[model samples]
Target: MLFKTLRWSFLFTIIGLAIAFLYDGVTGVTVTAILIVLEVSLSFDNAVVNAKVLNRMSEFWVKIFLTVGILIAVFGMRLLFPLVVVFVTAGLSPIEAWDLALEKGNPDTPGTYGYILNDAHPLIAAFGGMFLLMIFLDFVFDEDKEHHWLGPVERALSKAAAFPGVSVLVALVWLFVFSRIFSEESADMLLAGVFGIILYLAVNGLGDFFDGGLEDELDDEGERRASTGEVVKATGKAAFSLFLYLELLDASFSFDGVIGAFAITSDPIIIALGLGVGAFYVRSITIYLVHQGTLSEYVFLEHGAHWAIGALALLLFVSIGPHIPEVVTGLVGVAFILLALWSSINYNKKHRGEDHVVHV
Candidate 1:
């Protein structure tokens, strides 16, 4: 199981080094290595959350997640996405945007790609933060959810789900405050945040709507069971919906990393190589969690991931106007993950002698 989990990790590392070596001799390799570590450290929470979501997907979709999905993650998000952001915002042609992305340490120039990309930081933060905030809120506020990792706090939030749109309301309120305090382009930030919420609602709504059509039987938990036949077809559709969600979720998470990569190296090729390889490893970890049933066994792991996400959301918003260390973000995520692992070990030990261990 361990080997399977790390199978692609080693491969990705090799690929990363080769790409870096091809791009910029010895220095490129060093930058790429750093970026890969940065990506993994910052995104461990993302992998955890992804595991929970990926657990429900069909086998075929899981295959897609590994195969075709890597392309989208590596190239679409890491490589071209930044260029696209710069192009759309700065009115730069594709070639021009690419060149600007390669340019390093230049001050803000009018209509330049670096200037525009940097300027979009607040907007990116607002969008990703609100979306992640909504994800955290929705998870913690589910009245149907019985597992409470934070005890009183989680229990209380779970009850709040009784109120419709509670998550959205909370997200929007926080977004408004962030827009005012953290961004000079306050209106743009606010608008982006609004769109973030809308996007979340749309994706989640579609998933829920698809779930209803997916199966005839509902288990004791009330989640639709993919029994067979038409239900199986619906499962495909549902998986597609979730796939889209996962991809977008990945995009939201990558915004900060992509922007941060520019600070490490001016070469877009190195950024893509490092970040893409790291992202591939993350995908492997998610699959490992799913296959090993790590999420079910280590109960608080999901909660810790969500909490880390909450932290990341706040960090992104805060970093919009301030300089927060990347190490800070990475360390915070690692802390939660380690804490959860410790808790899970304790939970396992305590439950080992029980007749029926409640797998919460």
Candidate 2:
């Protein structure tokens, strides 16, 4: 079962290594291996969330996610995205940015590719932090959510959903507080963060709007019945919109990992090849979790994943003011995942034979 599930991962890993070897012999191969591991460690929770969303999408869309989506992820975000960032931020041409990215020096020192990438940390953090914050908010505020790993806190957050736009408001307030707390030089980051929040709202709002009338029925009480919607049967335009959402979500998670990769190596090709392998594994893991019904059995796992996302969002903002080790970001996510797994085990032990469990 595992081999059948992860065969694609194996193929990609081999391809990535071969590409790495071609890039610079042993040094490229070693860096690529390290980067692949780094991406996986940093993105385990990302796999869980991707699984949750991908399970809802149709098979065609899932295939597209693996194919075209992988192209976008590998080349667009991992490689081209940084150049775009440098171009926009430093007013350099694409070629100049690429040259800058290849400049070798200590990552901590200025005038190197790593330095330029790391220098944009605040901008990257602001965008990622806001986008991820919205996702975390949406999950915690989902009124239909029954399982809770952090019971009291999650339950309270859910109640806030009663107020429309509370999530946006809270996210904005967080951005506000962060801006004030950070140095005056970082005040501009709030604008970037707000734009991130806006994009989340726009994208998710479009998704909800597109979902209109899909699963609504009147209850005998003359009120709209609560929708126990099954997996989406989306097609055409609906599928496209969902595709956009998934890609944006992937982009939000990728921001930190891509930036952090510079700390490993500044070669764009190596970064793309390395992170690409890890991304392939993430997709495979997502498929495995969905088909095996891991989320259904281990209810608290989703809870933990969202909590980890929330932590990551906050850490991104906090890192704008203080340097945070990439290891810290990766380990925090792992901790949340493990804790959620443990909680799920305990929940199963407590409720061994419930006649029913919530599927969605």
Q: Estimate each model's TM-score.
A: 0.91, 0.92
Q: How accurate locally, in lDDT, is each candidate?
A: 0.83, 0.83
lDDT of 2 by residue, 147-254 (tens): 666777777878888999888889988888888888574566887898898898888888777666434423333232233443445555566777898888888888
Candidate 2 wrong stretches, greater than 4 Å: 213-232, 356-360
Model 1 regions more than 4 Å off: 105-112, 216-234, 353-360
- In candidate 1, position 110 carries an lDDT of 52
Model 1, 119-155: lDDT tens per residue? 7888888899889988989889887764666778888
Candidate 2 Cα deviation (angstroms), residue 50: 1.1
RMSD to the true structure for each prediction, in A, is 3.6, 4.1
lDDT score of model 1?
0.83
